[model samples]
Target chain A: MDEKDKEILRMMQDDFPIVPKPYKRIGDFLWMDEVSVISRVVKMMQDGKIRYVGPYFNSAKLGYSGQLMAINVPEDKIEAAANAINKYDEITHNYLRAGEPNIWFTLMTPNEKRAEEIIEAIKKELAIDEILSFKSKKTFKIKVNPA
Target chain B: MKIIDERTEKVLKEFQNNFKIETRPFKRIAVKTGLTEEEVIAIIAKAKEDGIIRRVGIGVRPALTGFGMNALTAWSVPPDKVDSFGEAAAEIQNISHCYDRECPEGWIYNIFTMIHASDREELENIIKSLSERFPECPYKVMETLKELKKTSMKYFK
Candidate 1:
């Protein structure tokens, strides 16, 4: 990404306005047209520089209960397992990490009961014996951006 | 841009509740709020600029999409190096969330990094590199098991 692209990414990573004409507002700030801003964002997504674009809502306030889920899947089956897990809309993000329980993902539901229901579904579908769910007791820090 | 009027407040609250999947949904909201579509657009623009609303988009849970592995790696660094260390940690792509927290007695982990990966091995490799990069500091890995909350702030209330 060039300097201009980096600037665009930086603006995107920070707070993106929730207005209907968000692209236009961004264009106004950057002295570019709304179409150009939209095109750049689309290109960034296509190039894999960004995963997706949209509002990063506060799920907690909406009464959704989520947890960090981890499991140990055989290295060979990691891809397959991840694919199966990704199929669920409730599963927002999944990651591969280096640790005892390598497969990590997040699950969100309208409530704790629903969240557990989704977890049970995964266990049954994946046939995994060991799974760890870490629920946050307190939020120490939660922000997404480059400092 | 006027401090959100009562009608605008009602509209925003509804927007948070009913984020339907359809084109020109804002028009529907405008209909409900008794405002023109252009007014609805303008209010959202002003609220966002004022930092009252962060974004109007999807909220995804990272683990379910195959980015499953994540851990909070804490590092004990000299007071002089904390700022630079945080800057370096923030540059790592996989390290999404980084911050400084007050360390408890006998546990001086002031610098924390949030590392996400597809598996544990990958996460460990990143931590190893981080450890090597900052050999003088001691670190610990705290994995997250549950996410109690994952939403942005809404100041419309």
Candidate 2:
């Protein structure tokens, strides 16, 4: 990404305009055309400079319960376990991190009980020993931007 | 102008509830909300600009993607260095989230860092290096055990 791309990203990340002509608004800010803005954003996504381009909502306000859960899975079984766990729409994020627990993922459900139930199901189905789930006690803040 | 019209509200609510992973997803939303494709797109674009909505993009399940080792590491940097430290920490590619959070008296953890990657050893190494860089500041690692909820905040409802 060049300086112009960086500038465009900065604007998009900070606040995307709410107007009939958003690309035009962005273009106005950057002194570029709407077509140029739209094409640039598409290009950025294609280039993998930005993983996503959209609104980020505050999940907690939506009445859903979420937590970061980790478990110890054998090196050989991670892919299988991940595939199994990822099938659930509730599992927003699943990742293999470097830690004692090894496998970590985020589970979101309609309520707390369902959240626990999902974890238990994973534990039972995966037959994984030593499952540690950390329910978020408090959320300070979560924001993502390209710096 | 209030960016959210009745039609827009309906579409936003649907998007919030069901983020379908399909081709031409917005068209589906338009069908449900009784708005034209251009109208739906316009409302979403407007909502995003107003900050009433944030991003309309894919929500990656990070752990499922193999970038899972995540933790919130807090450090107590001297007041003078907090800004630079935050900038430095933010510059790191692996550090996804960085901020200045409130800390208790004499146990201030003013600087916060989030490290996400596939390897624990690498995460530890990065933390170790951070500790070295800010030798005076005490730090603690709070690993996420379970992701209880990971949905976006829906304001319209």
Supply the TM-score of chain A against the true chain A for every candidate structure. 0.81, 0.90
For each candidate in turn, the interface RMSD (Å) is 8.0, 7.6
Error of 1 at B45 (Å): 6.8
Q: For model 2, give the RMSD to the true fold.
A: 7.8
By TM-score, the best candidate is 2
Model 1: CA > 4 A from native: A18-21, B1-35, B42-95, B98-112, B115-157
lDDT of 2 by residue, B32-144 (tens): 88787678777777666665564654334456435657676767778787777777787677787675654433445666677776767877988988778878888877665
Report the C-alpha lDDT of model 1 over A1-147, residue by residue, as the tens digit.
576666666565656555566667777888887777777766765665565444454555545566667687878887777777777667866766656566767777767787777778778888976467655433434555322
> lDDT, candidate 2, residue A127?
83
DockQ of each: 0.10, 0.10
Candidate 1 RMSD to the correct structure = 8.3
What C-alpha lDDT, on a 0 to 100 scale, does residue B42 get in candidate 2?
Answer: 74
